[model samples]
Target: MNFLSPLTEGLRGLGRAVLFLFTILAGIPAALLRPRLILQQIYSVGVLSLIIIVISGSFIGMVLALQGYRTLVNFGAASSLGVLVALSIVRELGPVVTALLFAGRAGSALAAEIGLMKATDQLSGMEMMAVDPIKRVIAPRFIAGLVAMPLLVSIFSLMAIGVAGGHAIGVELLGVDDGSYWSQINQAMHGTDIRDMLIKGTVFGLAISWIAVYQGYHAAPTSEGVSRATTSTVVVSSLAVLALDFVLTAFMFH
Candidate 1:
């Protein structure tokens, strides 16, 4: 019975989380009626995250280019460096890495802010004032996440910082043939690659936002509980991102 208790609790938690997610989803229409809330959350979570995203994307791209150039040069295929970096960043790294970073930065912040609100009885205060916190609070953040992720992935992989960093490293620094670099990238990249990135971004955004909000909403209303929820938000969101990336890749690429 004791061993079964853990499994039972796990299943119960899963059910509650799913219900919480659905409630937020259900509130989205009403939440949308107030576009200012969604816009505010977007600026909070998305705009504030741009610095880290751009800097990290640049560094990740540069590292990919450096390592890829070495391997391709060994194979006398240095011209393929651009394709390798592009595919790697666009197909995998951009979405997954960005999600992880988002989980750490924005997701944890969401959890903490919400958890603290709960701890301080602010959510209760809202309920007393006849305001539904789900529509007023959670849904806006959830929609903002959904809206921001695909755009961030595009900036990271497609036309801006990440690919540009790779180009700088591969072509200018390594002196790889510039024509072949751009030409191979243009030739090898397909619509499917872009589709995969967008899909992954959107799915990851949903999962991360769901977990963050759920954890916070259910956290015990205490300082320690709020801290635990914040930590759980980051840990659980990261693991979920990695696992979902694998599943999405298998399904999408297969």
Candidate 2:
């Protein structure tokens, strides 16, 4: 019975998260009218997350180049560095990694901020004023997360292509023929590849934002509760992104 308690709580949490998502979606029409709020949340969630995204994307791209150069060496196909980098980043790495990072940074912050508001009675205060916090607050953050995620993913792909594929590995260090690298990528990649990635980013964003807000909104008004919610937001969001990636990849590729 004791062991089952955790499982029960987990199920309850999942149900709550799902219900919260429906509420957020239902409020979307009204939320759109408040563009200012959505934009502010976008800056908070997206713009603030850019520095980490850029730095992480750049370094990861360089590292991928370094490792990929070794792997392609075995086949004497070093010129395919661009193909390897582009395909890996565009198809999988870019969206997945960006979402994971966003979950850690922005998602945690969102959870904490919302949780703190709850603790301070601000959420309750809104109810007293006949205001729906779901529409005014949570919906905007949800929209911003969805919008920012794809943009962040796009930026990540660009960094990976330029820094990892073009500059670090293919051109500057490896001396691979630039013409072969670029031509292979142009020939290998198609519109579907780009479309699938956008789909992935959007899905990941939706999952992360929902988890973050759900945890915070339902959290107990205590320091420990808020802390737990914040941590849960990151862990759950990251796992959700990876799981979604696997499922999305299977369908997209199959």
Candidate 3:
């Protein structure tokens, strides 16, 4: 009981911190009326994330097709390759993988940048000048992350499908029917899966950006503190993505 108390308290603190940051982000409109911030967010979150998501998505799809084909062949069921690839990539792999990549790329950078600013007392200087740090700094990043994640995930899903389709054509060298491949994929992709992917991407994006900024804002006032905060940001955000994935899966599927 004594040991569990610390864990519970820590979780409670984390929850409160997240809620506070989210509340600030949500209230940005009334505080800061800048259209440029939205454009910046779109560029930072969406445009910058395209290359990584595309490369990762394409390779993952190819690998999945290769692996799935080999496994299904062992059971004399090779014709179902398209269904398996599409279902796995769209329903699960697309959103989760893209989000994890986004977290590692953009999330870490956001944390380090904010942590550095805080360590240098720039944030305090802004506050002394009557600037609202939430409006000027946090809100833009939060909105950018939220908007960019879904766009990146959708691109990833599309690229992955393209890669998988090419891989399927190559698999026909082993006598798999080309006509049956696309048909199986069409059958497997339900409308609900698309909605689930979008929802999961949005949730993951919000979690990653929120955690990154929160860690940066709360970091200790030292170089080592900034480093620790950056590390914590990446680790915590990745774990949160996975945990939320499970929760979403259960809720959406059950």
Name the top TM-score candidate. 1
lDDT for model 1 comes to 0.89
lDDT of 2 by residue, 132-229 (tens): 99998899999999999999999988887785434566678888787887898899999999999999999999999999999889888999999999
Residue pairs in candidate 2 whose N, alpha carbon or C atoms collide under 3 angstroms: none
Model 3 alpha-carbon drift over 4 Å, by segment? 1-5, 163-179
lDDT of candidate 3 vs native?
Answer: 0.83
Pairs with backbone N, CA or C atoms under 3 Å apart (clashes), candidate 3: none
TM per candidate comes to 0.96, 0.95, 0.89
Query: By the lDDT metric, which is better: model 1 or model 3?
Result: 1
Candidate 3 per-residue lDDT, tens place, 1-254, comes to: 89999999999978988686867767678445786886787787679888898888878877877778789989988888878877888889999999889988889888888899999999999999998788888888878888899889889988776653434343544556776677877787889989999999999998998988888888887999899988988899999999999999999988
Model 2 spans with C-alpha error above 4 angstroms: 1-5, 163-166
